[model samples]
Target: MTVEVQLLGGTANQGRVHRVGNTVRRPLRPTSAAAHALLRHLEEVGFDGAPRVLGVDEAGREVLSYVPGQAVTAPPPCWGLTDEALRSVGRLVRRFHDATADFDPSPYQWSPQVPAPFGDGGIAHNDLNLDNVVFRGGTAIALIDFDLAGPGTPVWDVAAAARLWAPLRDPSDVTDVRRGRELHRLRQFVDAYGLDAEGRAAFLPALRDSHRWMRDIVREGAADGVPGFAAYWTAEAEARAERARAWFESAADEITNAVT
Candidate 1:
């Protein structure tokens, strides 16, 4: 009998992911079919930065190939905080977007939470949070947790990544060494991703939308009493989010100048 090791990291799916041999078992969701198809397409296109979708298990869990790497979790490690790791994330995301360019997502019943005008570019790895990406040899190698994977633009994905990686938040909320260097990191990430001039022009607006999008998800999740979301939706968290919005509004020109 194979032992099941509970995988940690990610608040949304906390305690729901397990490792059995060389596979990962996760709870099936309404969006699993879409996610599975997306993974299969990635494989067909030779993208190795994501997990492979195996059949469902007897217990009704979606089985996937276990990718071995260290995810950048809370209170990130020194290696995960490096510019190299950030650049690697940019390259990985670029590759993922390129691979999915031909995928048609109209048939799949994607998550309804993905707002309009945002999902048309292609099927994107909507949640590119720090913990969602896996790193090997101090380099970002793969992305996990496809629960939020669905219709999205490449710029949207880049914005999500920048929001979390460069962080784009109130400096007071950032206790790490990355506190004052958010804009510099943002420029580094976009440069590494090779975002085109047109994409660069649209990035700041996408970043604003990305911020609102994520905040809404967390708020709705907390309202529905999801244990993890509820815990994270404290007054402090709300205050910080508000401050981030204000900061983004005030720094819009500065941010635009940095990336362009």
Candidate 2:
């Protein structure tokens, strides 16, 4: 009944990661055929940029291929925040977008529809926090943690990625010493992704709204009994949310003009 290995690592939000022999099972997530179908479609028609579906584990957890490479955790030295790394992440994301452009929409993660005052991006890994991105050769070559993947706008995903990589945090949390350089990274990312006029135009507000939207979900997950989520709300989560919302508000014109 049992035959495998178990390893531990960080998750995008807060969850358990277990390696059972040759496969990985992410806690409290689904391994639906639809999800597998999406992964397969990405492999077949689009970019082969995602982890492989390995069915369910013995404990009925979502099983995925144990993707290799380093996840970019924070407290990074300045080099880890290099322009080249940012550009690589941007390019990889663009490739992912291009790869999945032809996907048929159905059976997605999270809600199938996004609400007003906030435009949602299409099917994507969605969470680009440093932890979810995989680095190789000093570049983010792959992505993990598709818990938030779903139907939405490329704008939302781009903005969210920009928030994490371009950062969009208050200057204080921008602690890599190369501080104040995130704007340049932001520009590089948008340029690499080739977000057009409309896409860019939609970015600023989408970015701002998405922060609150995401916080709402995280807190909701906590409220709904998702383990570990509560820890976030009680910690830097509130401060980060405040910082991001404030920064986004203050930088509204600049972000809007940049994306425009």
The model with the greatest TM-score is: 1
Cα TM-score per model: 0.97, 0.87
Q: 11-30, model 1: which lDDT tens digit per residue?
A: 76778899999999998999
| lDDT of predicted model 1 | 0.89
Q: How accurate locally is residue 91 in candidate 2, as Cα lDDT from 0 to 100?
A: 85
Candidate 1: regions farther than 4 A off: none
C-alpha lDDT of residue 47 in model 2: 62
CA lDDT of each prediction against the hidden true structure: 0.89, 0.71
lDDT of candidate 2 over 1-260, digit per residue (tens): 65555443353334467666666777654435556777777778746557887777657678888777676665564555788888888888888877767776654545434445343345656677777777777877777776666666777778888988877778887766446876777888899888888888778877877777778877787787766666557657788778878888887877776656
